[model samples]
Target: MKIVKAEDFDLRREVEYGSPEQNEAVREIVAQVKQQGDAALLKYTEQFDRVHLTAGQLRVTEEELAAAYQQVEPSFVEAIAAAAANIRAFHSRQKRNSWMDLQPDGSLLGQIIRPLKRVGVYVPGGKAAYPSSVLMNVIPAQVAGVPEIVMVTPPSTGGTEGIDPYILVAAAEAGVSEIYRVGGAQAIAALAYGTESMAPVDKICGPGNIYVALAKREVYGVVDIDSIAGPSEIAVLADDSADPAYVAADLLSQAEHDEMASAILVTPSPAFAEACRAEVQRQLGELPRRGIAEASVRDYGAIILVDSVVEGIDVINRLAPEHFELIVEEPMAYLGLIENAGAIFLGPYSSEPVGDYFAGPNHIIPTNGTARFSSPVDVDDFIKKSSLIYYSKESLLSNGATIMELARREGLEGHARAIEIRLRKEGKAGEAE
Candidate 1:
């Protein structure tokens, strides 16, 4: 880890937009899926995943879902069930109902909140195959009352029954059964444009590789997407009272995600900063993903020495990290000072993984300083809001002239006429009464 002054360190990381070859390849793949449908999906599955499959084999069978249970342990099932419950409970609070407000003029105005007709969730396979992510993506859509939640993963994740059984088990526990045995940009196009095997979805959510991210960006307007997620990030603001070992372990948890992941520490105490730097190096050697974590720490990780905790908070706000931990002596007192963070974990025990796995908050958060404006995956991602307006004749007569004036000011003659004709028909042509 590198040590630098707060003023000297730059936290802005360049966003990965994929290489030109990768982008062109994704465009070609998306075009093929749009034109060929299921045939393109199967072809890409064989090309990318090296797994040959017929159109009939593209969808996972009930037997596969049932068999997935046998491969996973009883303990895993129990734990997933418990985690699902917490996720449901947390997201259920976020569920909203359609509302209409009645006015004195007999007009009705409000929003009609409705769940999407269908949704597609892409789960990564192989090394990135996290069962917790299955819960994170699927459960919220379910809570939002989305009628159809479809999942897609590669056919084989170097596992004997094709897809990872643990992922299948997680999907089953999350109450999702419409899973397809396809992956990559082709699957994204299939979800967006519809195929013989799968219908088009209203929205797509989940995390994937560079190709997947590019595909999501390609199909964004056709079907709403959660976000163009970037590398994982974590920042810790601690003091001398905080445990250096605990802070180091928390930082590594995110750094181990990949070589692009970032982990940083901001503290006013020079002694605490040195101790954490040493502790991170010590703990990095013990991680199973040491090669990846070591690279992340060496390239993106840093410790900034601030003049005071207030200055540290200012730096954190500017960074707007994906995950933030406050480990000062009085964590609660400083909570109000945090302006930007995807997820804030205060005190020592509220580790980042707690929110990632079991603490009920969605781990799919904004990254690359996007927390300044965006938010994590939630029920709102699975639902759409339509504005409801029911104007009474009296209300229209009262406001039609103002509406026409604004429309004409914008030089939209048709819009003004649309309101003027209505007013004229009602015998108030000159001006709204």
Candidate 2:
């Protein structure tokens, strides 16, 4: 990994999200899915994933779901269940209900919080299958009280009959039954615009490759989507008191995710920075995904040296990494200083994977410096709010002239007229006009 001073670090690499060709391809795929429906879905599935299936076969059958249990170890089942419980517990705390505020004027003002009717969750089946993601995506929607959650994944090659059994088992454990064997931009398009077999949903969530991210960007208005996540990234802010081995291991965890995945370390101690640099090299040699991690660390990873831990925090906020590990001596002392970060792991024991796998926080986070304004997947993603107003006759009569004056000042006669007509009916015509 490259070592750089905080003053001279170049961040241009983090800003460029995807290529134009990839964006254009996603646009074409989304258009085809919208225009041709299942016909388009079938063609793209065959072309991209090397699997051919009819419209009837797109939806996974109950028999397929039942058999998935036999393929995995008993322990896998137990682990997913425990993780689901933790996730449910954490997100349930975030669940909200409709609320109303009564006024002295006998008018009612409130907001109605209702779950979305349906949502489509995209699970990437490339490089590796993420069963944990099924739990992360589905549980929040369930907690938000969404009735229907549809999952989509790419079918693998080598005559694989259906979606990965691990994903199936995770979905089942999370209480989701509707899943489709399709993925990429085509799947996102199918979810946005209903086909003959699959109904369109109100929102789409989950993380995917550049194609999937670009597809979500295109379909924002057609269907609400979770934030456009870029590559996976983790930033570690540590000091001399932190362990070098722990820092290196945690950095490599994110590096192995993808070639574009960034793993960075920011520290105030120059001696500790060198120690971590050496440890990362030693650890990188033993990783199974060495090539990918090496490339990621070599290309995107960095060890930034700052004059003080306070300055390091400044650098961290500017990056706004998806996963931030604070391995300093007093983690909580600097807690509120961290204004940006999707999820923060405090101390060496609270590693990045702790949050990713089992700690109850949603693992799907905003990447590519989007944490400055975006957030991780949560119950809010699967719900919508409607403002409620009940204006009584007396309230309108009391405020009609003020409303008309405000509307007239804005040069909106039609708006004033609506209030004028109502005020006249309420015997306040003199005050309305």
Candidate 3:
């Protein structure tokens, strides 16, 4: 990894960045799905997923799920259960309750929270089967009280199967209703604009390939999306006290995710920078995905030696990494300074994997540079809030004129008349004036 002084690092170049071809490809897939619907879905599935799924066999049955349990080891099943429980427990805290406040004049204002009637979660089964993603996406929706949760994954080929048994186990633990043998952009399209076998979802959540990202972008207006996620990333703002080994390992955790992923180390120590660089080389050899990790670190990774802790923090806030690790003497001291970041990991022991699996925080986070304003997937992603208001005659008359004036100022006569008509019907017309 190349080490540079913090002043030389360019964040604007990172922000104004995206390939035109990617945008064009995504737009085309989205249009094709919107027009052809199920036909388009099946065609893409056969082409990309290597599965010739008939419309009738899209949904995974109980027998298929049972067979999955037989295929996977008991230990893996137990782990999924454990992770599911942790994810469920943590997200339960995010559950929102409806509340209405009534004043003396009988005016009520509050929010009514309700889960989406049905939701679709896309789990990637191409490069790898992510059972943890199953837990993160489903548990939050379940906690939010979504009635029907549909999961979609590519069917396996070469004597392989659909979603991994561990993924099925996690889904069972999370109370997901249906699983579909579908994948890629086509699956996203099916979820967005219901196919013959699939019901359209109010919202779609989870992670997938570049094609999936493009599909989500295409169907965003038709269905709500959590985010248009990018590649994984991590930024560690450390001091001299931070351990080089831990820093290198955590960086590699996100780096191995893809060649596009970025891992950055910001510290005030030259010695620490040198040590981390050496540690990364040592650890990269041991990782199963070393080639991917190496390519990612080589292309996107950086080790910045800042002049001061404040400068280090400025770099962090500017880049807005998805995973922010505070490997400093006083991690909390800089906590408030960190205004951006999908998830914050404090202290040396708080590794990135902790949040990825057991930490109870959602692993599906805003990636690339989106953490500057975006957030991680949460229970709120599955729920919609409606503003509820009730106004008595007295309350309406008192507030009506002010509302009318504001509406009329904006040239919205209809809005003003709507309130005026209500007052006129109550036999209290022009009372406010």
Candidate 4:
């Protein structure tokens, strides 16, 4: 890890807009799925996934879902069930009801909240296949009351011909039975533009490779998407009181996710900074994924020297990391000062993986500095809100003139007439009464 002064380090990396060739390839894939429906979906699955399948084989069978339990350990099932209970309980608090406010003049105004009818979650296959992701994406949608939650993953994972048993077990535990075996950009297209075998979902949520990300971008207006997620990131704002070994381990947890992933440490003490830097190198040699983590720390990881803890907080706010750990002696004392972070892990005990796996909070968070304005996936992502408006005759008449004035000032005669017509009829009715 490179060590630099807080003023010298630059956190921004070039945003990934897939290359022209990749974009064009995704566009063509989306277009094919839109045009040929199931045929194109099957064709692309065979070509990309190297697994030939009939349209019937695209959807995972009930027997497969049941047998997946046989492949996974009983302990795995217990852990997932416990995690699901915690996640469900946490997200249940975020559920909202439709509300209407009545006014003194007999007018009604409020919002009508309802869950989306259907949603699609894309879980990547192979090395990226994470059971935790299945729970993170599905449990929230279920909590929001989304009735039909569909899951799609590649037919093969880690050179195996079937979906990972752990993923299947997690999905089953999360109560998602509608599973599909297709993947890549084509799966995204099928989710957005429905094939003969599958129904189109109202929204799609999950993470994928560059092709999947580009495919989501291509079909955005056709259906809602979760986000264009970037590489994973973790930033630790620690002090002399923090353990160097523990901090180094937490940073590597994210760095091992991808080569583009970033792990940064900001501390005021020069000795603490050196200790963490050396510890990261020592631990990096022991990791099984040392090559990937080494490249990540070499290219994107850093240790910044700050004048004080307050100055360190300022630097962290500017970085707006996806995962932030405050490991000072009094981590809570500076909690309110953190302006931007997708998820905050306070103290040494709250490691990032706790939130990633079992800790109740959704792990599908915004990355690439988007934490400044975005949020982690939650119950709200699966629901929609419609504004409610009910104006009484007297209320409409009272506000009609003001409405028309604003409409006309904006040069919209049609909008003004819309109010004028109602006002004229209501006025006549009132006069007769």
Best by lDDT: 1
lDDT of each: 0.92, 0.91, 0.85, 0.91
Put down candidate 1 lDDT per residue, 93-190, tens digits, no spaces. 99999999999999999999999999999998855679999999999999999989999988773322288899999999999999998988888999
Candidate 1 or 2, higher TM-score? 2
Report the C-alpha lDDT of model 2 over 296-393, residue by residue, as the tens digit.
99989999999988899999999999999999998999998999899999988999988999989999998888899999999999899999999888
Candidate 1 wrongly placed segments (more than 4 Å) = 157-161, 429-433
In candidate 4 the C-alpha lDDT for residue 55 amounts to 87
Assess the local accuracy of residue 275 in candidate 2 as a C-alpha lDDT between 0 and 100: 98
User: Model 2: runs farther than 4 Å from truth?
Assistant: none
| lDDT of the structure predicted as candidate 1 | 0.92
Q: Please name the candidate that would achieve the greatest TM-score relative to the true structure.
A: 2
List CA RMSD, all candidates. Answer: 1.5, 1.2, 2.2, 2.1
Which lDDT value does model 4 have at 158? 32
On the 0 to 100 scale, the lDDT of residue 373 in model 3 is 73
Please give each candidate's TM-score. 0.97, 0.98, 0.93, 0.97
